[model samples]
Target: MKIVNVVKPAIRILPMISKDEFPRMSIEDVQNNYFWGELINNQEGMYNFRKIGMNAPKDSLVLFQFDNIIIASAELLDIEKFVIPKDGKYYGAYRFDINSVKIFEPITLAEINKIDSNITAFSQVKQEINSLFMVEIQDLIKSKQMPILPDELPRQYYGKRTEGAKRQIVVNAYERNYKARQACIEHYGCRCVVCGFDFAKFYGPEFEGKIHVHHVKPLSEINESYEVDPINDLRPVCPNCHLALHSKIDGKVYDIDELKSKIKRLINN
Candidate 1:
């Protein structure tokens, strides 16, 4: 299969909570709070709130709801956990980490109930919850803050690969490589293994357009014809770095580490 670039966009809502309301609350505590409110959208109308919770093993997803409406949500990975600033300019004195927020179309109670039931079933099996936390619309109105709008929410790019393609790649890599790629990305802070670009601007569609996951040891070079392992073989790299690393002569793969070192030298020079 030809190597292709992929970019996926995700949505998250960040709530600027009041420090006075949650002076010493940890992330767990905040997630456990059943705060709910409406998230309005100019294009899609009002989305009702539902449930709010976290995703575990890694508690990286924090969510809040209105009824079935997801008013606020955020990914915990990139967040810098800290206390609210001393200044009281913001509505909620407390602040949680957030990349971007977005308002989707209003969700129905039936949908909320379905999600709740699903969560309950999954919880029985110790599965992670990925739903909203329903809050009273009256409370939100009383607070005098306009309903959270989808346009006001932040935007996240999931990746460029289609769901099926991503699944295949992830599964294939895991079976063959055994989590090496994940470890490397985590170790490198998810930055390009060679270029060391960490700017958020390089994120979203634009970044996805230029970056790709590469197989360090080309599958052809592996002695065994077994399935590919994602963790071991896959590494995120910019297009230029990937090409340089893959440039070869006489069927011999170029030295990836050497290429990286040369690129670093050139950058420094």
Candidate 2:
């Protein structure tokens, strides 16, 4: 059952700490904390790195999953980056509207696979929900009448598999984000930062503003999705320079300065 094509906001599947794994807090306890808006205040939402992606912003729907089951839903109210002193590590935390939280009947991954097989893995699902899919999930949650028994669940309930599809999704999202690219070009100009290749000077006015915005921080290194700073994180480069930038030597991708120096040395020789 599909709902009206309303509520087109981004949706994400957030994995929660399972009681079987931690033995400290059960999903029910977490649900109670979330319902009372105490999760963030208590720092229970903090993770080693960002869990939700940049695409998921305020008002985005979140499906809280424990083990393989979608146990609850909430609307993201805000997200913040915090540093933990005990570990001296940066962590991402989320704050969701307690009033919007709905602890629902557990929807297993096997059941969700019937709805959309594209969700092959929990890690693969990430923040890749489309409008139609979002509506379908919204309907699924609304249709559920009761919450699952948190105490009666078995340990090691589900299996996990990793797929390369997530990498492709992140690559596409990083490269195709228009606002980030535009802001990068606006800050750095249309010339290639590595070789100073100007599209307009080479191909005339029609080709003006044509440049590939390269992500300075490789997507492979980013363990989790976090906010990206356009000016600091992106650079305009020609196709050739972009390829050169990606070329690995001794397992190291060349930075702008390293690539530029190599180009200068080659040209002078």
Candidate 3:
């Protein structure tokens, strides 16, 4: 006859007196004294700890369990005064909400080792997870659930081999223009400093994009002496207005300050 070994599960531990419970304690105390558990089941899940409150506030309950045993527990008197330690060890003090507290049986060291092995295998397959996310995003765009723009995709995902195709040139030229446009917009508002056209609604098919940033003296004409003066050389102009500013037949270059003053005069008139 063969004998079968049957292990009896341990009983959960519970608190004996309701008055001994406190609100919250420092993270160091929790780590040193309480049993810890992961907030999530996966490796990416947050880790949390549970403990008996020493000065728990009113209407709050503290509960603890270990396998099949009920550990120490308590009820709070003034929950608001509970302050968790701030040394960055544990997630800060949490309120005693019944829904937030979850009790679970403690796992043995052997069980934890098994979990570690599973996590190691999952980490090796990260590329597959990222691919799934990209496919989901593409589906959203095809379904018209997300707006697709030339520059809207994350930079890392824009030109990679995995990305379907590229149509627009993503250059740092726009950065320089953005700096100049912001200055002009801040000084004169979104209204075109020249033609008085508002570009607030410039998106979509109605407008041919927003306003354009122009180099007041035409970047080519600027003597090497002024190459670094962004504020003095840059100004914002709407597409039509920018063309008008360059309409002079004499090919004379205008200073940015002068162009701004000209627009102000037109607006005033």
Candidate 4:
């Protein structure tokens, strides 16, 4: 039966996770600790890095698959550009905000084969990651009126995928976020610390307030709690230099001073 929804999903299943997540913990362990209210991040979601959030639609269903079986269903929420300090294809990227997650019983290839011969092979089916037809979803999410086997309580799940699409949790760096960003901008002025690129001067007054603010000290280094002096802790930077500031190319922190020196070297050359 085609269960018609007034809002058809913008997209269906996204093979967003696998056995490869949260290396130190068991799936059960992560389920309890990190699954809900978590933020998943990825840089290579799109070439633009900012549009990764467009893949999922708000208030639509997205089935998270793992090992070729539907593991959970999540409601797509917010999408935003998230910058992280790392050297990789997904250095800084956008993330999906998911919530109201319901984990389904593991649906295997054998089970799917019983349902349809065309999708007989596991690899073939999973390769078509988001190729979920509505009937398939009905089977995976529920068998009938009864819930899928032993029902797991639905939890608030969040996701952040980057570099090959793995789901991650959101940790609150509450201090870093709650600080008065406008005050920092007022004190430092909107100019890239490394190259002194000012948007207003180059792109006109329309772009006067378009600079990205970067954290001088990494959020991870804040020791679980922090008192931030916005002026000292934050710096206004152009988008390109902001990315460079967090670039851990060759596993090294390319600090602001180092980037400034490199700019000088480039000029001298």
lDDT by residue (tens digit), candidate 4, 112-169 = 5555555555441223323345566555566622221100111222222101112332
Location of the lowest summed lDDT over 10 successive residues in candidate 1: 161-170
lDDT by residue (1-269, candidate 1, tens digit) is 99987432222332333354457754322322322211211211122211232223222343344323344443333322224422433212112222222223433334444534544321112133332433332223234333321111111122221111111210132112213434445544456678775435566643332334566665444534454444655676765666666666567655668777877788899
lDDT of each: 0.37, 0.61, 0.35, 0.50
By lDDT rank, best first, the candidates go 2, 4, 1, 3
Q: Which stretches of candidate 2 lie over 4 Å from their true place?
A: 1-8, 19-25, 33-55, 83-90, 124-127, 147-269
User: Which ranges in model 1 have alpha carbons more than 4 Å from their true place?
Assistant: 1-189, 203-210, 249-252
Q: Give candidate 4 misplaced runs (Cα > 4 Å).
A: 1-59, 62-179
RMSD values for the candidates in order, in angstroms, are 19.7, 19.8, 22.1, 19.1
Top lDDT: which candidate number? Answer: 2
Q: Compared with the true structure, what per-residue lDDT tens digits does model 3 show for residues 1-269? A: 99998532111123322223223543222311232222111211222323332332243334332322223222222222225643433333333332232322332324322423322221111111122233332233234222212212222211112222322222111112233345555665555655566666556544533555555555334322222233555455666666656556368644445666876898799
TM-score of 2: 0.42
Task: Give candidate 3 regions above 4 Å deviation.
Answer: 1-177, 201-209, 223-230, 250-269
Sequence-dependent TM-score of model 4: 0.41
Q: What TM-score does prediction 3 earn? A: 0.26
User: Which window of ten consecutive residues has the lowest lDDT sum in model 2?
Assistant: 150-159
TM-score against native, each model? 0.28, 0.42, 0.26, 0.41
Candidate 1's TM-score reads 0.28
